[model samples]
Target: MLRLDRVSAGYGRAQVLRDLSLEVKAGEILCLLGRNGAGKSTTMRAIMGLLPLMSGTIWLGERSLSALPAHEVPRAGVGYVPQGRRLFADLTVAQNLEIGLMARQSGPEVREQVLTLFPRLRDRLGQKAQTLSGGEQQMLAMARALCLRPEVLLLDEPTEGLQPSMIAAIREVITALRAEGVAVLLVEQRVDAVLEVADRVAFLENGQGGAVMSAEALRADRGLVDRYVGV
Candidate 1:
């Protein structure tokens, strides 16, 4: 339900993304794969209005999001989970989640939905985020974004550094989001992990246009993915 056309973005004179275009349809998990500094995260930043686009257009359904401010992105139906988790280390688990809901007029029911998805958070509502395990922190980061109930979810490596069990949990979460018709734009480097949940894959090449591949093709022979982004 989200599309970026001929998008070029940069910081000052240094360009990171060059004419990148891709799409994420409703209920489909589109995985963005590429080597480090391949503009994958830049694409996500541009989509979330966190980074200014030097030139291009971003759209959700019929609404144009090119000119929307960074603060309005979540309100515009796009939820973002940055690579580092970026949780408030000092804040209580519940407090961090409450911050996301403040952007909208939603009620506690939305919070409940997020809690339901990550049942582990239900009991640690009062715990400081820093004390939680790495996996738990990642779950909380994703849960905070889901509190926005976005039409399009922008996830940047939700399983970067965690145990195998956490990786499985994230995979199952992506599968569940697809079933719920939530369009997901997942930027992950772990080919095997995301392949189980991805319906399609897109490669973000540095200073070039991206190419799309069916998830099946990548699954049948993972070397196809390794060809572009490496194992």
Candidate 2:
């Protein structure tokens, strides 16, 4: 449902992604694995139109996402939870989610569905985002993105800094999203987490995609993880 073809993007003269090509199909979870500075986050930024592409194109089905402004990208059936969560620290959980709904012009039903996925957020609706624990903040971020009711979801390190239990909860939600037919493009440093939820894995090396493999294949031959991700 989401396609990136020979995408090359960077900040100013320092190019980070070079001729990168990949696709995330509907109902599929594709995890991107790479060490730091491998352009994983850059790929997410390129897809979100936060960084102007130096070359290539990004497409969501037939619509060219590269042509849309950053603000309009989310409205075009794309939901993004960038690394660091980037939540409105001062806003209450409910208010933060409301911003996401407003962006898509979504209704209360969408809010209900998101809250259902993140039940913990329901109890903390009035709590400031900055006051929540690390795991709770992460849940709120994902819940806010789901409020967009997007067909494609871009998640960058959604499980970072969370405890094992919270990690499992986040993974469960990701798997559920796949069952619901949301295309997921995830950038994760945790190999175990990737193996648990990803249908396929793409390795990024020095701003280029090196290999694409099924999650099972990687599980069978974990050496690939060391080769690509240096773990």
Candidate 3:
């Protein structure tokens, strides 16, 4: 559903992604694994149009997304949850979700679908987002993105600061989304959690591409995980 071809991007002269090519198929969950500073976040930003591409192309299905503006990318069915769970601290959970709805041109059933995916959000609809715990905030972030009814979701460091149980919860949600035909491109620090949800995995190294492997291959090969992802 999403494709990046020989894409290179970075801040100013410090290029972080060097000719990185990758694809996320529709209804599939593709996880990206890399050590810190391996350009995973940069790849995500380039695809979202937050960072200007120095070279190459990004496509959503058959449409070219490389030249589109950042705001337009969301409307084109790409949703991003950045490294930190960036939520409106003072806004109620419902209000934050409502902001996301601005991206959708259709999907009247958006709220119903998202609420079903995140039931914890229902009871806290009126509560301020900042008052929630780490896990709750993460759920709110994902829920807000889902409110857009995006076809492809890009999640960066999603389970970074959550408890094990929360990680498991998020994994279940990722699996459920895939079952429902949502394409997921995830950048995760926790290899095990990502492997649990990913259909395939790619490793990023030193601002360049590394290896692409089936989730099962990565799971069975402990040495590959250690060598590429620092396990």
Candidate 4:
């Protein structure tokens, strides 16, 4: 389980999150929905220790992650896929995957697990990341994160800048991850997609959290969506 207790984070002198709090249980997908600059990315960064927390605590299961550094955060069983894919354009696909595996404390068995999910990557292991299509790069990004064998995964805008088919493929992968009991914290702009896949939804506005409800409940409440998540 992952828990954010009244967490507040920001850049130098500019606050992006205001006492935000939320939780994602094991084997569940928790979606964070909001307009651009609503602190969705900030929340993910804070959880991963990419950004320093100004206040409150972040917990992974029974352990506290509030004081860990960014690189050290992932070793604690948290994997982060930032907003951009952040691939190394010069590196081959295999090289990128190798870097991810280096972060893991586990044995070679974890790399085997990642390759099982992204078999396509195995075939194109020698290709440069920049040469791959947008969809393929996205898949590689996800594959790299999974190589760490995280207990909890935080995904930011995973479906952004992709075709419909690619989105569906990624959705299938996420579903499979959940089935394997990996908790996911997903932040996305697609309301319908979030409603379809999320077990629970949290609507964030400005820097504060508004309401937390089940996917079905959020889907049924059109007023709240319009008020906080205008199209």
lDDT winner: 2
Model 4 scores worst on lDDT over the 10 consecutive residues at: 104-113
Best by TM-score: 2
Which residue runs does candidate 2 get wrong by more than 4 Å? none
Q: How does model 2 score by TM-score? A: 0.99
Each candidate's lDDT (Cα)? 0.88, 0.95, 0.89, 0.89
Positional deviation of 56 in candidate 4, in angstroms?
0.5
lDDT of 2 by residue, 1-231 (tens): 999999999999999999999999999999999999999999999999999999999999999999999999999989999999999999999999999999889999999999988999999999999999999999999998998899999999998889999999999999999999999999998889789889999999999989999999999999989898784
Name the TM-score of candidate 1.
0.96
List residue ranges in candidate 4 displaced over 4 A: none
Clash count for each candidate, listed in order shown: 0, 0, 0, 0
Q: For model 3, how does the per-residue alpha-carbon lDDT over 8-71 read when each residue is reduced to its tens digit? A: 9999999899999999998999999888889989998999999999999999989999979888
Q: Model 2: which ten-residue window has the lowest total lDDT?
A: 222-231
Where does candidate 3 clash, by residue pair?
A: none
Better of 1 and 2 by TM-score: 2
